[model samples]
Target: MIEDDAAVRRGVVDALEYAGYRTLEAGDGDEGLRMALGASYRLLLLDLVMPGRDGFSILAELKKKRAGQPVIILSARGEEHDRVRGLELGADDYVMKPFSVRELLARVEAVLRRTCERAAPEDKRMIPGGEVDFSEGRIAFEDGVEEALSEREGELLRYLLEAKGRVVSRDEILRHVWGLDPAKTETRTLDMHIMHLRSKLRDKAQDFLVTVRGKGWRVVS
Candidate 1:
């Protein structure tokens, strides 16, 4: 996860973990880039502005140093040129600040899903327990059991799995999963749902949720 605001960082990181993902976090573009390169993660969540390197420079370095990795820019750079420039500089996608969680998850999911299927075609999706088929939305666990998920859980899980390796943001989650318009409501509601999801899935596979300090959730390897 990459973000500057301290408050945003905490909320986002918690949400990402509760949602079942592993994450790496950075406060600015330079740190984001360093973490991105130093790690062998499947996804990169980047911020454009920073104390030193800035997002644009980071993107350039990411492309130059780690050509195969995919990048998603999360920043205040909502201007048209900024978006285009990010893409041109090898950023796979861009998300402006004050973004919607629904949109963020959707974009993150689309990028990771697409990339995995393209590069690791043979083992792209995880078939947990021979009962839990992530892509299929059906689980075939013990007792030869199989079931469908509620609409919201399905969406949340989908997004988590897609990134699978980085903390997702809270604003991103609320906007994306609940489609909640920005409001004054407490964020605790998200925690309840995550607990429920965690309880249900833990028995079937390796621990999925990892709480990244001051960041969001990620679904990692």
Candidate 2:
């Protein structure tokens, strides 16, 4: 959790702890940004308005470096723009301030549950001149070289492999991989990560991660 307000931060942390969830918190954006970038956590609870490096800025950085992270924004701003911008920046959910503890907890549970359900199964895939070991999170090439994958990249590849070569829409990718509703959010995060994954796999997006024109993407090979 990252909140500037002491009372709200304490209350939320207490509630989460009471509910059997362990949490790490920061009182300002700078600290939160450091923790967000370095720590290993299942979910992040962020405040939009902070002393420095606001949540939106933090979220943008996360999208670039940790796009698979699950995040929910807590903010006093209830304007359409605020909410829309958060979603566009790849936040999984947005909770307006003055929200009840009950409501907040419920949202937290829902997001976590959806994320858990999207967990990728263990498997390995054979690709051109190399093979991907999902369980090991690495690629073994014919030249005796290997490249490791980040957790997000592995999950993305796992999801694509699960599609069995069928075209999957961007909306479907968001729903299954990011656990966000495609209709409610606008983001190119999915496309960016897909491109990154292709580069890691040493395959062109058009060849391996096929663009289905008006649809989404498919792993053809």
> Could you give candidate 2's per-residue lDDT for residues 83-186 as a string of tens digits?
99999999999998888999999999999998768755658788877999988889999999898998878888888887788777775667667877665788
Model 1, span 25-76: residue lDDT tens: 8887667766765654678877777677787888787665455468888877
Stretches of model 2 off by over 4 angstroms after superposition:
119-126, 129-221
Q: How far is candidate 1 from the true structure (C-alpha RMSD, Å)?
A: 14.0
Give the winner by TM-score. Answer: 2
Per-prediction backbone clash count: 21, 0
Task: Give candidate 2's TM-score.
Answer: 0.61
* Model 2 poorest ten-residue lDDT run: 168-177
> What C-alpha lDDT do the candidate models reach, one value each?
0.68, 0.86
lDDT of 2: 0.86
lDDT, residue 170, candidate 1:
61
